[model samples]
Target: MERPELPLPQLHAFVVLAEELHFGHAATRLGIAQPPLSQQIRRLEDKVGYALFTREPGRIGLTPAGRELLPAARHALTDLADGLTAARQVGSGRAGRLRIGFAASVALTVLPGLLRTFRGRFPAVDLDIREMTTAPQLAALREGSIDIGLLREPPAHDTELGFETVLDEPFVAVLSASHPLATQRAVRVEQLANCPFVLLPRTVGPSLYDQITNLCIAAGFTPQVTQHAVEWQTVCALVETGLGVSLAPESIRRIRLKGVAFRRIEPNAARTRVAVAWRKSDSNPLVPRLRAAFDQDPPDGPRRRPNQ
Candidate 1:
């Protein structure tokens, strides 16, 4: 046999009638005449193929069928209500996962505070954070796998992806506390010509590699490359052990690596920027909220090329 459709109105009428146990009172609560309420209850019973109520000597009470349906009816209504609310919240950008990509250095600087504040406002948003280099981050943004990127290099103006500089500060030289330059308040880029240098591989970030090499060339010397490390912390660790010296963003000082001292680079040509990148047609509405949180002055205006 074909199942009858359980209309919302019929279920609602049955619920009210079951609760009241009196036709006139239920009809009053439902804002309808008693006769129409009776018809609705009859229709509800027909649909379920069961007697929902029993009447005896001016008294009315539920049959076993009505008692069984009560809880399910209330539960179904509540589920629908909650599901609708969730949909609205997602549409408004108040809830949902936001995939974020970043170079490891920013994790120690603004990233932690930015995430903490964003979460306080939108606790329901899941932050899927990935530590990626500038190149991979740009590719991820283009491929739609990530929503936002925190990068160390400036990206070219592309029609498909938009980029902005969040913080543009001059590079600082990283040295062991025992190194001769450690006592100097500022180290000139030309001063490190003969010193062994530690660096991140070009595959990790080509733009930063280009910036460092170009700065060295402008200073009238080629850097003597001695070592390469994968992460910023490792680079700092190498310097701390007196293995070699390196150039890094001022923000890297936040790591507070022991036995390491950061000195401002002279002439300020070797500079780096902390940038934000996203798809030009990014569908996630939360991007604006994120940009507003981190948008501030870049201590040294904007980072320009080393040659410039």
Candidate 2:
């Protein structure tokens, strides 16, 4: 059988009375009149189904039942107080769990600094960080699996999500260390017309995939894509093996493969943007807070929409 629910006020009164063992002193400690304190103890005992105190002329003491209930009631009250404190901290955005999904490429650029700033400001917030590609990161944000997304080339029009540009970086040509163009201070996009290309499949990142292809077209030749790799590092590795040359974000140069060389694209008008993305309908307070971390702006900073 289930025990009756005990009122918090009654339990509080009972604990105070048990500690003082004197109605006058207990009432004083609880800031209540003696009669009401006694009445609360009686109500708690009724719920507990036991006599909680023994009373005699000029003397008062706890019965065995009262002694047993004291420790449990004290522990319950302590736990409740701790839980309330934690909830308040979370409500104020000072402490809580924030799940962030980020592109692997940004880990080479913005991710580290963003994390450092957020951790410094909100030391109590627990972070669940996952490395994901643009497509998966967007999916996770919509599904509520991640609170924030740091990704490349967020879609230009997505009513379901809000985005802000965090970094705008130019593309660079990646070549094998021994390739002829590797020693060039800068390479024009059109110079690679005859070279077979290694590229990321459009399925993984449509915007970025199209950006590269469109840059090639603007240079007057559609890249003859000969191989596909999902990650920038893999693309660089393929270039290193002389499988094909590629173009990637300037951040890709940080991968540091000894056999790979990165050269600036002359007239580097084609730039890639990394953005912070979140569901527009998201109610998590941490979402806005984290987005600010991405921009190194205050939480109230001006909002930048996708593709801006």
Candidate 3:
């Protein structure tokens, strides 16, 4: 025999009747007349080909089949209600996972503090974070691999992405403690033009590296790059070994290394502008919460001491 379609109204009537146990009261609770309520239950029982409830003069009780099915029925209805609520929240941007990408540099300074504040404010949101270079971060944002990105500067191809400045970080020079300029209170970009430098991979973004090169040019000579590293820490490590000097965002001071010393660069020639970026056409419900996470102000900026 073919199975019959389940009638939602009949199921609803059965659940109400099971709770109230009295037809009149169940009908009142359902905002329907008693006859219709009874008819609904009878229809449901007929569809199932079994007596769901036993009825005697002025009394009602669930049969064995009804007792066995009640728990599953209630669970189904409750799950349906919860699913609908979650869908509504997703539509309104109140719920869902937010995947975020960040440059290695930004993660060291602003990302940590911002994440703590975001957790406090939006505890329910699931945050997925990935460390990527500016190029890959921009690619991830455009391809929908991530919902947002914390990166340095605006993307070179601006038509596909939207950017908002989150912080402007000044450039600083890092070198081994034994280096001559490390003892200076503050060093000028001009003084380091001839020093062997460690450079970020040109693949990261030409404009960013250009900012450093342009500063050296303005200072009167080109830097002699003795080494290149893909990440800031590796570059800093090379600087610590006395391999050469490097220019990095002032925020890099937050990371402490035994042999390294950080000093401010004079005239602030190359400032790194960190921005929160997203795709122009993509819309993720959790974008605002993710943005708020990066915008939270800390009681103090990352600690930087001239001699530490």
Predicted structure with the largest TM-score when compared to the true one: 2
Residue 173 lDDT in model 1? 93
Candidate 2 structure quality by residue, lDDT tens digits, 45-164: 888888999999999988999889999999989988999999998998889999999888988878888889999999999999999999999999888999899888999889788888
Better of 2 and 3 by TM-score: 2
TM-score of 2: 0.94
Among residues 3 or more apart in sequence or in different chains, the pairs in candidate 2 whose N, CA or C atoms overlap within 3 Å are none
lDDT of 1 by residue, 1-308 (tens): 78678887777888888888999999999999999999998988888889989988899999999899888777776777889898888788888789999899878666787787888788988889999988889889889999999888755557788777766777899999999999999989888988899999988888898888888888998888799998889999999998899988888888787799999988776567787787879878788767666643222355322211
* Local error of candidate 2 at residue 151 (angstroms): 0.4
Position 298, candidate 3: lDDT? 42
Taken over the whole model, the C-alpha lDDT of each candidate is 0.83, 0.88, 0.81
Better of 1 and 2 by TM-score: 2
The backbone clash count of each candidate, in order, is 0, 0, 0
- CA-only RMSD, every prediction: 3.9, 2.6, 4.7
Ranking by TM-score: 2, 3, 1
